[model samples]
Target: MTSTAREAELLPAEDAATYAEWFACLAEPTRVRLLQAVAVAGSKSVGELTEQLGISQSTCSHHVRKLAEVGFVALNKQGTTTRVSINPACCTGLPHAADAVMGVLAPRPCCPDNLACDVTVRPLEAGDWSAVRRIYAEGIATGNATFETEVPTRRALESKWLPGHRWVAELEGEIAGWAAASQVSNRTCYAGVAETSVYVGDAFRERGVGKALLHKQVTAADTDGLWTLQTSIFPENRASLALHHSAGFRTVGFRERIAKHRGIWRDTVLLERRRSVESPE
Candidate 1:
């Protein structure tokens, strides 16, 4: 009907009808704003959405219904309030929108070119703890990696890496990053879940060392039958957050004032990635 809608119809056809519906649903400025709000707030009820966006209840309900009609949202009645969540299927299909939005917003890649540094990822060994500890300590000294007061000894660090779950990144024979999974909880019920930790040397930050280590660690953990991998990250750690997000972890929730650091309370965000027997492409 509209030029934009016609253009959307002519675009590639991975899911033509679905994309048409999504395009029609998103064509409205109000609806686009509403979806942006929901993406930022995770989920919201009609009343909450209205209050936040300064729209009337009927208007908010109308836009939400349009979103649901296009399969972009799901509504659950919670007594007098209705809760809405972004449909995972639709959310996963939104990369086109993301790219378009980025074209207008960022317009430039954050890291356009890769570093020329030589790096390698391999199975971590017991003998590597000294180098690992030193790298980790350097990260700690910069206040960017961990909250641990002191670096662990070789035995202490080795005890944490369970069989079938160890990987490290090396740069010119020096350990740059390491990642391993530990039992999520002492309780047996949580045995299938494990919490993962990754640390990269300060000198190797943003050089792809963390990404390499995560790929190897996640692959090993998945092969070992770990169903869920989790981590707690300080809210201020943007690089670590980007690494986990790129590796497919989703932010589940946040804990307020979970730890005290540098004489101030710090919040931690919880992130998790579900691993299946099938490897990721």
Candidate 2:
């Protein structure tokens, strides 16, 4: 066992008093292993857990039962197999559990070595057209963002983006990402609403570029008196979902087969961030 595993074993004892049942349940090596497996799989059945961990079916069931007893795992009957998944509430309440577990299991950040570059959020500039085109080109190639046929020309895009609420993220003095809000509908009734979009260069993604762009767009829209800003994100794009949620966007609906890409239909989720009831001065 590595030092981390050894530490995991002993650390639970410190909180044993308040979490006696949980600690005691996790004390068993087999139960701990089962919990780890379930956490990794998101949700798993008894048989699937046994196969993944290379443990006996009966032993897997026993350890899973222990985990469930302590509230670390929840079991659901799925036909002949029992499906088990981590109880997020239980793990979240246990101090340091998330950090310790994720440190050992989660993938490292993509841009871990690039500390010198800082992402900057600011209003879009007059000459940011080239950078905006480059960002849009990258997003277009990915096939996950936007339905535009090709990167819009600088003059055309700037005419549309510059006049309305917009923001861009600069990385090391280069425009790496951009987001903007446009009127949702031309009718005067929808004047207080806008649809928002964000695009980031592939190289700068997962480096806080998207969030920075989104922050600027949201702030700019709020400042411009847009009461509600909305966006539709592809269901598979987890990063976009996280960005919108962090920016206070609430999921309002899901549209199935709203768009097609590469001969397949894509489902888009609608999200909106409303200006707080308290107005921005």
Instruction: Give Cα distance to truth, residue 253, candidate 2, Å.
Output: 0.8
TM-scores, all models, native as reference: 0.59, 0.56
**Each prediction's whole-model lDDT (CA):** 0.75, 0.75
- In model 2, where do residues sit more than 4 Å from their true spots? 1-117, 162-164
lDDT of 2 by residue, 24-142 (tens): 67778888788888777789888888888898999888888878876888999978878998898865665445334334222222112333248887777778877888888888887
Question: Candidate 1 on 1-281: residue-level lDDT in tens?
Answer: 46775465443565556556678888898889888878777788989989888999999999999998877888999999998777777666776555443332222221223433587878888688777788778867866456676887777766776767877889877888888888867787887798888888877777788877877777677667777889989878888888887676767778998877676787889988776445442
- Model 2: pairs clashing at backbone N, Cα or C within 3 Å: none
Candidate 1 TM-score, true structure as reference: 0.59
**Local distance difference test, candidate 1:** 0.75
As a whole number from 0 to 100, the lDDT of residue 281 in candidate 1 is 26
lDDT of 2 at 270: 92
